[model samples]
Target: MPDGPHTAPAATPPLCEEEIARFVVERFLPGVDTGDLDPEYDLLATAVIDSLGVLHIVGWLSKQYGIVLPDRELASRNFRSVRTILATAERAAAVGAQP
Candidate 1:
């Protein structure tokens, strides 16, 4: 009733590596300290994320950002580090923003 258009604002800001790290630590690794997480840390190399964990992260991202990742994009490289995940999320958000 107030304007020509009414669009919902994003629930959260553009995803960043630090925030992704915090998400990973809090949601996936409950006991892990935030300080222990590095933006460039190799989650897979360190056994931080196993096969099942990858699925969990994928599900979380889909729900959190309304993203739909393709099977080709679900490679280990994309989920290797928080930095990479942040980049992937940003890309997905950009794509989702288009009309």
Candidate 2:
């Protein structure tokens, strides 16, 4: 046997673009298929999400990812697209995991 056995690294909470897309389509754009939602779609430009919707999304993110979103992360830019939202959530979760 080897002196030290290898072990898997701690798994970070995954923030996937598909998951974000599914949430957005379900919550804000009912009847819209997730397949139609592109990664770079302009959710704000298309009126998919408003200020109140943004708050709802922020709340969902905080609860789902177990991270308190910083005030700066509440910006609409962070939720502009599926890619952006996933990136922001992943970043926030990573930061929140630190001591």
Candidate 3:
């Protein structure tokens, strides 16, 4: 991934957790219904996101949100569940938007 700040088109919609869940469910965690996804479930513990999944998600996030998730924030806790992922994503975007 690029080490510099990221940017997107002005009309691109902001990041949404639903999109994230959709991507994960459709790509990595099929057979799992997003409607029943627990916000606090430990995704890594259940193998929902393996190493490859991590790279995929991080890449997708960077492209979609135009944010660089700092190396320190790549830990399991931040990506633990639906809620945490959304929170971490929002934080990254917010920080990246700063001047």
Candidate 2 structure lDDT: 0.84
Which runs in model 3 stand beyond 4 Å of their true positions? 1-11
* Candidate 1 lDDT by residue in tens digits, 23-82: 899877899888788789999999989878878888888877677777877888889989
lDDT of every predicted structure (CA atoms): 0.80, 0.84, 0.79
Tens digits of per-residue lDDT for model 3, 33-87: 8777767778889998877777778888888767789997787778877778888
TM-score for predicted model 1 compared with the true structure: 0.76
Clashing pairs in 3: none
lDDT tens string, model 2, 1-99? 879988996775467888789889999889989999999998887888888888888888877766677888888998888888888887787888899
Q: Name the regions of candidate 1 deviating beyond 4 angstroms.
A: 1-10
Candidate 2: deviation at residue 28, Å? Answer: 1.1
Q: Largest lDDT belongs to which candidate? A: 2
